[model samples]
Target: MSVLQRVVKPTTHKGKKILLKKEPQLIEGPKKTIFFKGRKTSDKIRHVLKDMYDLKKPDGVMLTKRNDITIFEDVTPVENFCRKHESSLFVMGSHSKKRPNNIVIGRTFNYALLDMIELNVEAYEGLKAFESSKILLGVKPCLVFNGPLWEESDELKHLKSIFIDFFHRESVNAVRLQGIEHSISFNAMPDGRICLRSYKIALKKSGCRIPRVELEEIGPRIDFTLRRTKLPTPELMKDACTKPKELRVTKKKNISTDNLGSTHGRIHMGKQNINSIQTRKMKGLKKTAQERKIERTAKRKALTESNELIKKKKVHDD
Candidate 1:
């Protein structure tokens, strides 16, 4: 008997191509931040609301359609719930006939409001309502502290850490504001208030009076809010880390005995300060009290002996 060989057809009898569907990649960090929409607001206004945190939809709308950014009939219950969960931050949207495009972003802990910022929607063109489900991408916001609070106290530093923790959800270095591309300046006021101003960083032609370098103010001022609130706990702030490690103030190493230039005999007592008026060296270099007293006594005795010699010479001449 001859061996039989079978040939297989690659295509289906219906003439359809076999294809594999692409799997959607899940977004990261929505758990830390949320967008809460109020029930009374119009759907158009509510859905069109956008923040740096929200992702853009393919249909030209900003996506707030996630479980993290849910719609609520009342603000009180949602806020209370967020506090109970010890959430760091949540955004609340409210619009009315009298007030248009009102958004209140707040920081929360243990069901209490720490800081609340109210912003009204300005003119935003080309934004529509669409179904969106994407994560925040390509955001590097600069934080500028332009007032005394930048250095006067640790309060602003603590507050800044909380903001970093809330914004930096994706990676360890994601939320750092290094270059001027996109930025949020946390300008503090002397009156115990923080004026947060957001801007879109861009390069532009310099004026004749100024340098030829590119400018930083790109689009219209993004948003500004002023508020005062108690800082959140450390558990709620992970990214609010200390300042970029102060270049580690490299200490001068001890000179080794092998080096001839090194003198190890003199012990370093402490810092030195001089008193010019007293004609005295610093404590570390000062002469002993007994030595100073002896010098003074010697000078006085020499003057007395000179006077006595002059008197004896005059008596001999008489």
Candidate 2:
């Protein structure tokens, strides 16, 4: 094969289609993740990465081999892997003297690096540390952000959204009381530290209609201090968050509802002439042709009588 042909075409049609850019879809599928490590990693980092992969479940792909790529330095390898694996989210673990037990959590947009954040794991705990039963595979997790710092600081705000996107499994309309099995809470400390905790929800029988709720710490607890953060530009963020036309709520005109739960609609019409309007056919309401003639004659006679009386008064004065 010629060099141009080899470079341009794929061996199979499926490969060719996979290489092509994806169009905007009305309904998106679950976000898949790729987990990998660097050439050098501490035991803590490995355990944390594996635990995260477990949380991601069937949608996650873990790469066993280590690579010598630094995401903040050059993101080419990460982007290539994202395209190859068709995964938008990634978690990379690396340990070094300067930043020990470090992990970078990031996501891609359109097979390109959109944003990433770096944090050092200060303390670690694995699932074995806790004795709670594990949650079901692919079960949706309820994420709770408990701290004013999440909204007060821009970096924490970004991290909060990123964490939600990473751990979110699917969109649901209504949740059952029994279906809520697990929850993940991100608590922001005052000293710029993060306490990531996982809990298993246990509903106990109660006399009332609502069941009593209990939370059990299910392991993989880790404390992280913020190190570095990178956010996408305003334009890129806006474009990334734009909703598809199919999902947009189109506004209806001239229709409204009031507080009383009644619907009202306004109708427009051209100018109306009362003279041409059709009225009730009752004799009392209708003016016949003879009645109309009589009314006009009475009005004319009254006017003439007033004129004659004025003339007589003028002649007497003269």
Candidate 3:
């Protein structure tokens, strides 16, 4: 009798939210972020980071600091952590005896490091709070850069630093830029301040409906608000020069200059030593004087024998 029963509806209500049975669509924007700190990382710094990013406690983004973690340790844990939590971006911090203050920021794709930037602690007073920008790529992406390899400006260096690899080989040109998926820009400021910006290239049509390629800033404008700290003695910085005792003095024991070691001052002298590149160079002085003398004598003997044969032939003919 009730083949078509009426669905329940609340009074004075528009409608109940419908839930899709399918898995959620992949996040197109900057979706997830994870933070991993070393065991030795300061609590104050962690607190500051939590406040700055407004991260929630027990979000699974804050990872437990494992012991035996070093600055030069393998990044497999980071890759695994991100993969486990489905995080796209991660900030790794470590305060080591090797590198006093260093932090590495990186992004991942399918558990592989897409890009990373390491900031060395030049000077740090105290960090109370910091600000970070949320960047996102448009639907499409393309890469763009300028300058040659050797004489590339500092700004170009900073721009190229964030990108793991853009160009296929060494050289990049307009011909090799086909099917490029990301847009990279290396131009910085006029005062030599490095401010790299990445863009996503998209096509937008005007009134005529003709598609025009456009670029929009995506993510990663890593600008650290420098916090002033009290550095150690300025006297520590001094001009390095070779002292009198630093010069290699010839000793009279049995060793000569040549027997001392490699000419390139290499401690480990072996066949595979890279300092032996000079041996591959072109040799200037070829044949020795004694070798030239012997060659001349041999040539003269051959010529004299030929002359004697010719004289005999003339005599026979006569």
Candidate 4:
């Protein structure tokens, strides 16, 4: 009898969960420092920070503690943090004695800020999933505040409508809000680091209404009217070419020879006229006979010449 050994292989059961461990990579904070400066002291800054934190609430706000702010350090990190958390709304609050209370509301993508101003909820929901899902991509909204309070004006209503239409179209996602000290002066900051200062708010509103008049119809209408006018036809052209000019006739009276009682002059004229008529008739008859005689002579000469040439040739041959 041979001894047989049986071995069991471990098998994974269906629906069993497997755990995988991922190693964490340490990332260093920005080497540069960021400082938030305003005309007011840091006490006002702290107050503004608190207000912003309260407004943002549950999402929790990320603030740079450094005294100096840089493009690579402060702005970049805030943008990155917003993207990592998939934050839909961003509020920027700055306190300065020159411009006491100011807030900026905006939206962002993972890569670039949209050029237009947008509301918070609308901006986030409107972002394209494929673009926003990328790593390390940051975007911000264009700032909308300048001059006066944006919410108070008719221009605000128009601008809001335009923004809503644009957002529904998913055309843009970033904006910035700025604060200015003067009532007439304001600043608008967009994501591209561009700023418009002391811009007139009324001017922006004046352009809001869509132009009602249509320019496209003008060209076709003019063309149609022009086509209706009568063009010159061939008949009209022929008539113009063949029309006769007017003739002006002037009548003149001459002294009569009969009134002078000259019988000799009259008799002389009658004889001359009779003689001229007879001469013309005789010349016509003479010309016809001469022409016939010339034709007969030419025929006779041609026959005699041909006979002589023939005889000469025969004699030479002999």
Best by TM-score: 2
Q: Give TM-scores for every candidate, taking all chains together and pairing residue i with residue i.
A: 0.38, 0.77, 0.33, 0.23
C-alpha RMSD values across all candidates: 18.4, 6.2, 22.9, 36.8
Better of 1 and 4 by TM-score: 1
lDDT of each: 0.49, 0.89, 0.47, 0.33
Q: How big is the positional error of residue 189 in model 2, measured in Å on the Cα after superposition? A: 1.0
Residues 1-318 of candidate 1 have per-residue lDDT tens digits of: 995857444476343332211111132342345555664565444543553334212111232443232322234665665744435566666666765666655565445445544555454322222222222244544556687666666555655655564555343543323343555566666655455444555445567654344233322233333333344465554433232444334545563454555544435676657643465557876789899899999999999999999999999999
Give residue 184's error in model 3 in angstroms.
19
TM-score of model 1 (CA atoms): 0.38
Best by lDDT: 2
lDDT of 3 by residue, 109-222 (tens): 555554455544342222222232322322223445443631354323432533323122223234433344356454433443333345555556666856577665543333
Give the clashing residue pairs of candidate 1, or none. Answer: 83-111, 161-240
Which regions in candidate 1 have their CA more than 4 angstroms from the true location? 1-31, 42-48, 55-76, 79-86, 110-112, 122-136, 145-180, 185-213, 216-318
Report how far residue 51 has shifted in candidate 4, in Å.
2.8
lDDT tens digits, residue span 1-318, model 2: 653524556689888786563544577767889999987899999999999999999999999998999788899999989988989899999998988999999888898888899998998999989987999999999999997899997788888988988998778878998899999999999988899999999999899999999999998899999898888998988888889888997867998889987989999999999988888577678888998999999999999999999999999999
Tens digits of per-residue lDDT for model 4, 1-318: 995857433356432322111111132111111123322334434444453343223434455443232222235554564555545334443444443433333333332232113121101111122232211112122224453434554434334433332222113334322211111111222331212211111112335564232111100000000000112245543543342334323333442345656533222233356545645456555557777799889999999999999999999999
Comparing candidate 2 with candidate 4, which one achieves the higher TM-score?
A: 2
22, model 2: CA deviation in Å? 6.0
Displacement of the residue 220 alpha carbon in candidate 4, Å? 60
